[model samples]
Every structure is written in C-alpha cells, then in structure tokens.
Target chain A: MPTFRVELFEGRTVEQKRQFVEAITKATCESLKVEPGSVDIILVDVKKEDWATGGRLWSDAG
Target chain B: MPTFRVELFEGRTVEQKRQFVEAITKATCESLKVEPGSVDIILVDVKKEDWATGGRLWSDAG
Candidate 1:
C-alpha cells in the first residue's frame, strides 16, 4: 500500500478537498490494486509563502 | 516554512491526534522558529494491513 501526502496553498474549500481526496484515493486504489480503504492521503493546506516546489516558494515564484 | 507529514496506523483518538499535532508544531516552531501559521502538518492514518515501514507492512512486521 502507498500513501500520498499533498501540500498546497490554503484556499480550496472543504468540498474541493473532499473531492480531491476521493479522486486520489480512487486513482491510487486502481493503480496500486490496493483496496480503497488501504490507501491513505493527507492534504496539508498552507499559505502561499509557506509551500515550495523546486526550491521556490509559491509566492516567490508567482 | 516547512510542512511535516506523518503516517501512522489508525487507532489514535481525536484528542491524542490533537496533542501530537501540537507537539510537532511546537517543536518545529522552536527549532525552525517559523511563524506558527506558516507551518503545516498532515497526518495520515492507515490500516495495519496497509502501511509499510522499512519495506515491511505493519501487519507483516508486527
């Protein structure tokens, strides 16, 4: 089993987070052939200045 | 700012989870001294049969 950890800017609604979790769960279950309940996903919402990709914070890059 | 992600087998209560989060937040704040608001932590809970550590599933290892 595999777990996905996602961190992004904190602007999405709870509904969006719910849908995203559902989608990631579905894809992981299908791709990994694990039971849906076996997959775990964690979403961390952060401010634009807090999260980084490629060593550049979101706010800095944007 | 940095994000801390922890994945553990499911069993902790809400209060325990809250305390663990707070502990991590405090430690990060003290060590990194980033604004408390700038740090985020994501906790992922998985079934015993689903999670693996050191290349062994929890159920397999335990």
Candidate 2:
C-alpha cells in the first residue's frame, strides 16, 4: 500500500478535500501502479507556528 | 532521507510527541543507518471519522 501524507495550511472545505483526494489517488495510481483502494492518504493541517524553514518558523515570517 | 508518515488517533500531548519522535528517530537511525537529521517524520492526527478499516469507518464502529 502506498501511503501519502499531505501537509496543508488548513481551512480547506470538505469539497476541496474530496477533489484533492480524487486527483491524488489518480496520480498515485498512475505512478505507483497501485489500486485506488490500496492507496492511503492522510492530510495533515499544519499551523504556521508549527512549520519552520531555514530555522525560522512560518508564523515568524511576513 | 527516509520520510515517515505516522498516523495517530489524536489527543497526544506535546511531551508525548517529543518522546515519540525521539524514539522513532533513534529506531530509524539504527535500522536504516541514516543520521537523525536525515529521517523526516510527519505525525498525522487522524480522526475516527476519517479513518476506515475493512470498509468500515472507525467512527461508526461500536
């Protein structure tokens, strides 16, 4: 099973998630040759304070 | 670099997360022979409604 962990900035509607998963499933199937049912995707919503780049948190930046 | 996606049932405290990541990082290093910094782990808190097993959602399970 191919598992995908997607990190987003949060505040996405359910409809957006539905479409996102559908597209992601298709892409994963095409590349990994895995069945739709076998692909597992977990979307993680990360706050700006929780994420950092180059030793600086996203919330700290403009 | 080994990227790990960990799914949990949520409600874990910050100390728990810190310890979890440390242990996971150590285990990964020992097994994969990679540096601690090379192992990237993204912890995903999965809601019962969002998770399913054997075609049944966890939230629906009695």
Candidate 3:
C-alpha cells in the first residue's frame, strides 16, 4: 500500500486536485511498481495560520 | 516522539476530534511510553468525491 499524506496551502480547485492525484499516482506506480488502485493519497489543506516556518506563523509572516 | 496522520471521512464534529486525539495520545503514551506532549496528530478529512478505491471514486461508487 502506497499511502501518501500531502499537506499544502488551502485554495486549490477540484480540478487541480484531480490532476495532482493523477500525476502522483502515476509517479508512484512507475517508481514503486504498485498498482494505481492500491495507492492512497490524502490531501490536507492547511490554513496559513495553522502552519509556521522559522518559528513564525505563515499568516503572520507577511 | 510519536507522530500520527489519520485520514477518515469528513463530517466529524470538533468535540469528536478533541476526544479522539486525547484517546489516541493516551494510548500512544502507554504503548510507546512517550510523553503526552510529544505526540503529534494531524487529522485529514476526506470527501467522498476525493477518495477512490478499487479504481473508482467513492462518490461514484454508489
């Protein structure tokens, strides 16, 4: 089972997500030789406030 | 330190999440003998349309 947990900024469209998963699935299948059906991808949309970098929240970074 | 990424169908209440994380942290502490504060849990809510199984999206499964 090739399970993927991807965290990115919020605001992506459904079309973007669809294309992303398709590409990810393709890459995983080719690299790991796993069936496309067995790959599981969970996308997490994180608000800027919830994510921090360099000890500062992304929302407050600007 | 134990980190967990849990993915499940969306629609869970905040109270449910609070309780679930508490329970999971407790279990992890006891099983792995790690400190409660050291446990990190990220919950991902998945829509039926975004998840697929057996080469079919969950939304299309029905």
Candidate 4:
C-alpha cells in the first residue's frame, strides 16, 4: 500500500480534491505498477500560520 | 529532521493537539536522538465520507 500524505495551503474545493486523488491514483498505478485501490492519498490543508520556513511563517512572510 | 504525518478521525480539541505535539516531539527526540525543534508533526483530520476501506467508505461502513 502506498499511502500519500500531502500538505498544502488550504482553500481547494472538494471537486479539486476529487480530481487530485483520481489523478494521483492513476499516476501511482502507472509508475509503480500498483493497483488504484491500493493507493491511499490523505490531503492535509495547512494554515500559513501553522507552517514555517527558515524560522519564518508564511503568514508573516507576506 | 523527522517529519510525521498522522491521520485520524476528526474532532480533537486544540488542547489535545497541543499535548499531542509535545508528547510526539519528546518521543522523537528520545527515540531518534533528534532535536525537538527539528521534529515536525502534521495532523490530518479525515472525514468518514472521504476515506474508504474494502471498497466501502467509512461513512457507509455502518
């Protein structure tokens, strides 16, 4: 089982997520020769304030 | 640096998250000999409708 944990900025619509999962599943199946049902993708919507880079938060970088 | 992505059913409180991060950081530092500040934990709250097992969504499990 290939479980993907994806972290990205929040605000994507449910339709976007649906398309994302479908595409990812397809890509994984092609690249790894795995079944689509074995690919599990968990999307994490991260707030800018909750993520930091080089000791600075994205919200503060603006 | 160690990054952890955890997925669980939604509905945890902020206080619970605070405690969880603290405990996880401590455990990582102790187990992996890593610095507390270098440990990153991302928690994903999953809805039942979005997750499936055995070709059946969790929302329809019952």
User: lDDT of each model, Cα atoms only?
Assistant: 0.64, 0.76, 0.82, 0.78
The lDDT, on a scale of 0 to 1, for candidate 2 is 0.76
Chain B TM-score in each of the candidates: 0.81, 0.87, 0.91, 0.88
* Model 4 chain A lDDT-worst window of ten: A13-22
Best candidate per lDDT, number? 3
Clashing pairs for predicted structure model 1, backbone only:
none
Q: What is the lDDT of candidate 4?
A: 0.78
What order do you get sorting by lDDT, best first?
Answer: 3, 4, 2, 1
Superior candidate under lDDT, 2 versus 4: 4
Per-residue C-alpha lDDT of model 3 across residues A1-62, encoded as one tens digit per residue:
97777789999877677777778888888988989889887777889999998999999986
Going through the candidates in the order shown, the clash numbers are: 0, 0, 0, 0
TM-score on B-chain, cand. 4: 0.88
TM-scores of all models?
0.49, 0.54, 0.63, 0.58
Q: Mind sharing the TM-score for model 3? A: 0.63
Model 2: reference contacts kept, as a fraction = 0.02
Writing each residue's lDDT as its tens digit, candidate 1 over B1-62 gives 45656565687788776766665555545544357887677877879888666888788874
RMSD, every candidate, angstroms:
14.1, 6.4, 4.4, 6.3
